[model samples]
Target chain A: MILAIASGKGGTGKTTVSVNLARAFDSEIQLLDCDVEEPNDHLFLKGAPTGREIIGIPVPEVDEALCDGCGECGRFCEYHAIVSFGTTPLVFPEMCHGCGGCTMVCPVKAIRETAKPIGAVETRRAGNVTLVQGRLDIGAAMAPPLIHAVKARLRRDLPAILDAPPGTSCPVIATLRGADFVLLVTEPTPFGLHDLTLAVEMVRALGIPFGVVVNRVGLGDDRVHRYCGQRHIPILLEIPDDRRIAEACSRGGLIVEALPEYRGLFRNLVGKTMFRTNPKEA
Target chain B: MKVAFTVSGGDLAAPLDSRFGRAPKFLVYDLDKETFEVVDNRQSLDAAQGAGIQSAETVARLGAKALVTGHCGPKAFRVLRAAGIGIHYAGEGTVAEALARYRAGELPEAAAPDVEGHWA
Candidate 1:
């Protein structure tokens, strides 16, 4: 089963839950870091780089020689990536979504596809886990395309865990797509609860079965639990507001390895999450 | 020469909008004809992104010789430069006053984009 760990607020510990959950499993698993803008899972799950591939998206390139300046390409683009003033259409590579709609709409066929490198995905073998992380280029606004590239490397046979980016934006949606289940990690603060509500709405809209993992439980009030309980959302696990976990995380250490006593919690998390996804299998 | 001034109201008397890309309207002043026209720019104002590019295309298509705004972004600057429309700096005045400043050679031509993209 493919499980995704996501949070609506940054610093809510989505990466912490993802890495620890992967380590909880004794068997081999695949972990994908879909937060291309700032992928930090590799720092905890260190391994020699096994493979690397540059990710690119198709952007339109207009040929002035064959162009008729029909202004059709500009009208076809929704992002305003291409614009024409009764002359040659200008192409802005950064705004292009690589939809190829402009190229198809061009009557004179002056537009052609060109590859624009946005980021790179690298594969690393971290013990029994095969970690895949995508790193977007600096100043590159396209994170969804790079996230899709990292997800494309998923090995279907092996159980996969995706560490998604924060918030209910396009990048987060891209990471959560096609997952068997999602683990929405959040703290107990007001900011956490507010964003969690938005995230819950997002997952519900996508029609994906998901559960909540309340991290740093003692850090704030019981609003998160109260909110989840009222909404009938399952509280799969809760990690206390412990300084040990924080120190371990700061040193790029996995909680399961640093604190062996906490291994059982994450181990139980795997079982509970799998059972949530498939009641009969568990 | 037709010059475009980013404005916030319907006529030449409207306040000059400080923002160029997301300005509410553009006052196209025809210096030769001594007349002006107001072009609504609500489309660029509501754009999620690339408002500057769209605004530049609009001013260029309207045959503006220069754009007078409080600020200009890199993307809009490039497009305006490509269209041979010079961007000039003028703020804290009405559209008609800005146009007068342009004709009087008081408004300075922007050598480069005054601010980064997405500047408010």
Candidate 2:
């Protein structure tokens, strides 16, 4: 089963939960970091990338010598990346969505597909967990495509935990796609509650089963809990607002390794999550 | 010679539009015939991206030799320059006043794009 860890608000302990939860799993598991714009799972889970591969989309390239400029290709592109004024079409590479619609609509067959590099995906191993993350090229506007590349590394044999990006945008949606269960991580602050409501609405709309994991429990008010209780959303686990945990995280250390006491907490979290997802196996 | 002015209304007495890509209307004037035509630019105003490019494409298709506007972006400047259209800047004035200034050779031709892309 694939579980996605997501938080609509930025900096609410998503990576912390994802890495620690992966460490708590006694058996082997796979971790896919779909935050291509700013992937930080590798910082905590230090391991050399076992394999790296470049990922890109096929943008269109127009040939000037083929025939007359009918402006069909430009008219076909919905992104307005290519446009012609009864002359040769001008292509803006950054705006292209790589849909290849222009090539199909070209009557003269002058447009051809060309590869444009967007990002790279790396596979690394850290003990029982295999980490796969996507790193986007600077100035590239295509994050969803790169997120898809990261998800492509999911192993069917092992249970996978996907760490999604912040917000209810295309990138997060791409990561949450096809997930068996989603763990919405959030803090108890007002901002957290507001964004959590948005996330809940999004997940509910997608028809995916999800639970909330409240992090830094003592820091904020009880509004998040009250909202969850009123909505009947399950509160699976809560991580206390402890300075020791923050200290460990600041040093790029895993909570399971740095503080063995919290390992039991994370292990229990895994148990409860799995039991809810698969009652027969549990 | 044909000249296009970015305007806020259909008539030449209307205020000159300060934006190039998101201009509400464009007035194309024929110097030889002393006739004028208004080209609606509402489509570019609502474009998600490349609004400047779309506006430039329209101006080029209209066969305008010069463009008078408050500001020009990089993409629009490139397209207009490629079409052999000279870009000139005009201060806060009506379309008619801007045209009069152009006729008197008071406004200087822009050497490059006055503003960055998506300035408006």
Candidate 3:
């Protein structure tokens, strides 16, 4: 079974919940961090990456010697990533989507594909947990592909826990796809509630079973509780407003390891989440 | 010489638009015939990205010798400059007034793009 942890609002402790849950699973597990733009799970874990691989997308490169500047490729490109002005088509690698449309449109076949590094995926083992994460190069617009690359490391026999990127856009969708259950982490603030509603809509649209995990619980008002009750959405877990946990997080310490007292709570969370997602398996 | 003036509407009396990439309309005025042709610019306005480059393509395809707009970004400026299309500065006024300024040599030729890419 695969469980995805996501949150619409940034800094809602989605990563905190995911990293701790993986530790309390009590079995061989794969922990994949799909927040390619800013992955921080490895920092919290206590092992060096055993493997790393670079990933990239193919962008167009124009060969001026092979042809005339017919401008056909320029006209056909919807992105206008390549523009021709009676000279070799000027190719902007950043803007190119690598659709191969420009190459097809070039009558002389002057356009060739070249790989541009977007990011890299690395794997590390923190005891029984196999952690895979994608780290995108700064300024790289594409994240879905790198997230897909990290997902490639999923160990099918073992249950996988995916920590999705914040928000309900393509990257989050890519991370949450094909999960057995989705756990949305949110704070109790009004901003958190707003983004959580949007995220709930996204999960419902995708036809996935989802539950809410309210982090920083006692600090905010009771609106989050009222909203969840009204919607009939279950609150799977609630991490109270604790300064010790915050300090542990700041010091790059795992909640399960630093505060062994909460180990039972995280364990119960995993058990309840599994049974909630699959009643028959319980 | 045909000059392209970015405007909010199709006529010479229309107000000049202070945008290049997403300008509502282009008034291509022919100096020899002293007449104007209008090109709708809604396509670039609705584009998700690359509006500046698409708008420059429109000016080049219309055979405009020069472009008069509020500002132009680096990418669009490169395309227009490479096509040998001179760019000039225009402010808030009627297209006819902008054309008069161009004829009188009052409009300064832009050495480089005045605004950043995709300002519109």
Candidate 4:
């Protein structure tokens, strides 16, 4: 089963939950951290990556010598990344989405497609789990393409867990796409509740079977539980505010390994996810 | 001058329709003329969620001289500025009230939205 762990807000212990869960599964399991922009799971995982691959996107490069600056490329680009008037054509790399529209519209073929390295995907062996992660290049605005690159390395036969980026944006959608189930992690706070609603809406829109994992459970209100109850979404696991766990996270350690007692919780989380994903498997 | 207003649906004056691309039933008033033109923004694309630049382009294409809205990001701000459109920030109350404030020149000119990513 491909399980995707996602949250709408940052700092919700998503990496912690993912690492611990991967450790608990412990047998040829694959963990793909699709949070390409700020991947931290590798910091907590075991040793250096065994494999690496660079991810790139094709962006248009204009050749000024070709001929007259007709401004057709600028007119065709909906992003306005390229704007030409009279004799000059301004190209803004940051605004470019790599749609290749400019190259197609240029009558003189002045625009050529060139690859720009956006990020890299690294695969590391963490005891039993194979961790695949994407690290975006600094100043790269686009993330979805890099996320797709990381996910493409997923091993189909083995169970995989995808740690998605925060929020209900395009990157999150790219990470959660094609997953059998999604685990929405959130804290029990007002901001957490608000963002959780957004995530829930997003998962529902994607039509993926989902459950909630309330992290730092005792630190805040029970609104999250009430919300889950009202919506009939299952509460898979709840990790309370434990100082030991925080320290372990700081030291790049998994909760299941640091505190042994939490192993069962993660195991149960996997069990619930499996049952929800495949009722016949139960 | 014709203008477009960008509003996230959660705003009080935001139209009842959830289709974000459609413009809410709001008016862009001309303070000099003392008259208002109810701008139909239904045809414009929504920028409230993702791709602010695209939304800014939609607003610009609508021939808006000024944009009134609650919040905008840096990328969208740059695009709007490049289009030569004035921006008004913290526009509250009903859409009409905000337009009145714009007409009265009471609302401060909005500074460019920060360019840092939303997560940061």
Candidate 5:
């Protein structure tokens, strides 16, 4: 089963949950960090990337010689990246979505496509889990495409744990695609509850079964718990607030590896998640 | 020579539209023939991005030699400048009042764009 660990708000311990859960699986499991804008899972994982690949999108390049400025490309382009004012076409590479419709609509064949680097995806083996991460270039708005590239390497034979980007927008929606089950990670606070409700609405609209994992459980009131109970959503696991866990995380150490005590907790969490996602197999 | 005035409506009595890209309409006035035409700028108004450049392209296509608006971003300014179209800045008022200012040579030529892109 492909389970995605997602959070509506940032810094709610999604990487901590994802990495720890991946370690719980003894078999060959895949871990895909779909947060291309800022992937931090590699910090806690061991080993260097065995394979590296750069990912790019095709942006339009115009030929001024064989062209009349019909303004057709500008009129046809929905993104407004390409436009012809007078007899010259101006292209903003940063705004191009790589749809290739501009080139196709060019009557004079003056528009051609060129590769524009968006980001890179690196693959490595970190103990029992194979970690794959997509890192986007700074100031690039192409995170969704690179995230797709990282997910394209999922191993069907093994269970894939996807760590999604924060929020309820394009990047988050892109990562949620094809996920068998979603694990919504959130803290038990007012902001957390507000964003979590939005996330729940998004997942429900996507029609994916999801459960909540409340991190730093005792730090806030039981509102998140109460909300979940009212909605009848399963509480997968609750990791208590502890300075020791924070200290380990700050030093880029896994909670399971440093404490050794929480290894079973994470393992049990994984098992419960698997059972919920696939009751027949469990 | 023809002059383009960004407007809120499609008539002479329409108020001047300060927004260059998202203006509802443009009045293309001919200096020689003393006739004018209104061009729909609703497409640029609804454009997701590059509204300025698209509107500038429309102005160029209509063969306007000058532009009268309250604001112009750097991108749209570049497009109009490259098309050899002169840009002038006018304050918020009726289109007829703006035209009177233009005819009386009260408006100043903008050396650079007055506002940033997507300000409207």
Candidate 6:
């Protein structure tokens, strides 16, 4: 089963949940951290990456000497990343989606496609769990392409868990799109509830099966519970506001290792996730 | 001012006419002419999963002064705003209702949608 761990807000224990869940499983599992911008799962795992590959996006590079600015390339580009009216065409790499439409539409063949390094994907192994992660180049604005690169490493035979980036935006969608199930991890705070509602709508819109895991459960109000209750969405697991867990996380330690008892909690969470995804599996 | 509303299906038909009752695949309406034209977003070449920023810019370039849609993200919102196009966040409503609400001044000013990812 492919499980994606996500949260509507940042710092909601998404990485923590993902890492622990990967360790909880007995079989060899692949843990893919799709949060390319700031991947911290490796911090906890402390495993040296065994493989690394650079990811690139195609951007239009205009050869000014090739021909005059006919504005054909700019006209053909739907993104408007390339603009040329009276003078030489100007290309905004940031706005470029790498559609190659400009190259195709360029009448003079003045535009050539070139790869711009966007990020690098790293692979590592921790015992039975294989960790694959993407690190976006420091100045790169896009994360989806890098995420796609990381996801390409998914091992079909091993049950995989994707640690999706926080929030309900394009990168998150890109990461969670093909997963069989999504595990939304949120706190019980007002902000958490607010974002959770948005996330619920998003997952529903995508027609994906999902459940909620309330982290730092007792610290906040019951609004999350109330919302889940009304929607008939099951609350899969509740990890309380434990200082020990927080401290361990701050020191880059896995929750299951910090408090061995939590291993069972994660195991149970995975069990529930499996059952929810496939009732017959229960 | 000429405004654009994102519609889902092509052409206008009831149940589908208002932007309030249902979300438009994406629509661009000419306010002065009171004529609504459906923007063809079905092509994979311009299909952006979230906010559809590229599509929004296309509508803006087509001389739309404002936008009406069920939702939009920060990236698209910024692009629309930069293009001097206003945005109205109308939850799944018929295109006509959204347009009517805009005409009646009942719709809130288009602000950047919450900065959540595609899932939010």
Clash count, one per candidate: 0, 0, 0, 3, 0, 32
**Ranked candidates (TM-score, high to low):** 1, 2, 3, 5, 4, 6
Q: Please provide, for model 1 over A23-47, each residue's C-alpha lDDT reduced to its tens digit, 9 standing for 90 to 100.
A: 8888999999999999999999998
Q: Can you tell me which runs of candidate 2 are displaced by over 4 Å?
A: A278-282, B1-3, B7-17, B22-47, B58-65, B82-84
Could you tell me the interface RMSD of model 2? Answer: 1.7
What class would a CAPRI assessor give candidate 3's docking? Answer: medium
| Of candidates 5 and 1, the better by DockQ | 1
Models ranked on DockQ = 3, 1, 2, 5, 4, 6
For this target, which candidate reaches the highest TM-score against the unseen true structure? 1
What is candidate 6's CA lDDT for residue A267?
91
Which segments of candidate 5 are over 4 A away from where they belong? A275-282, B1-48, B54-65, B69-71, B82-84, B89-120
Error of 6 at B8 (Å): 32
Off by over 4 Å in 3: A67-72, A84-87, A105-107, A274-282, B9-15, B37-40, B91-94, B118-120
Candidate 2 TM-score for chain A: 0.96
What overall lDDT, based on C-alpha atoms, would model 6 receive against the true structure? 0.78
Number of the top-ranking candidate, with DockQ as the measure: 3
Residues A163-253 of candidate 5: C-alpha lDDT, one tens digit per residue: 9999998899999988888899999999899999999999988888888899998887899999999998888889999899999999999
Candidate 2 lDDT over residue span B81-107, tens digit each: 877889999999999999999999998
lDDT, candidate 3, B1-119, per-residue tens: 89999988879888999999988888899999988899999999899888888889899999998999989998889888878899999888998898899999999899988887755
Candidate 1 local lDDT, residue B16: 92
**Cα lDDT of model 2 by residue, A151-262, tens digit:** 8888898899999999998899999989888889999999999999999998887778889999999998999999999888988889999999999999999999999988
TM-scores of the models, in the order given = 0.95, 0.89, 0.88, 0.71, 0.83, 0.69
Each predicted model: what fraction of the native A–B Cα contacts (within 8 Å) does it retain? 0.54, 0.23, 0.62, 0.00, 0.46, 0.00
User: For each candidate, what's the DockQ?
Assistant: 0.64, 0.46, 0.68, 0.08, 0.45, 0.05
Better of 2 and 4 by TM-score: 2
lDDT per residue for candidate 4 within A97-201, as digits (tens), equals: 788888888888888888888989998887887889999999898999899889889889899999999999999999999999889999999999999999999
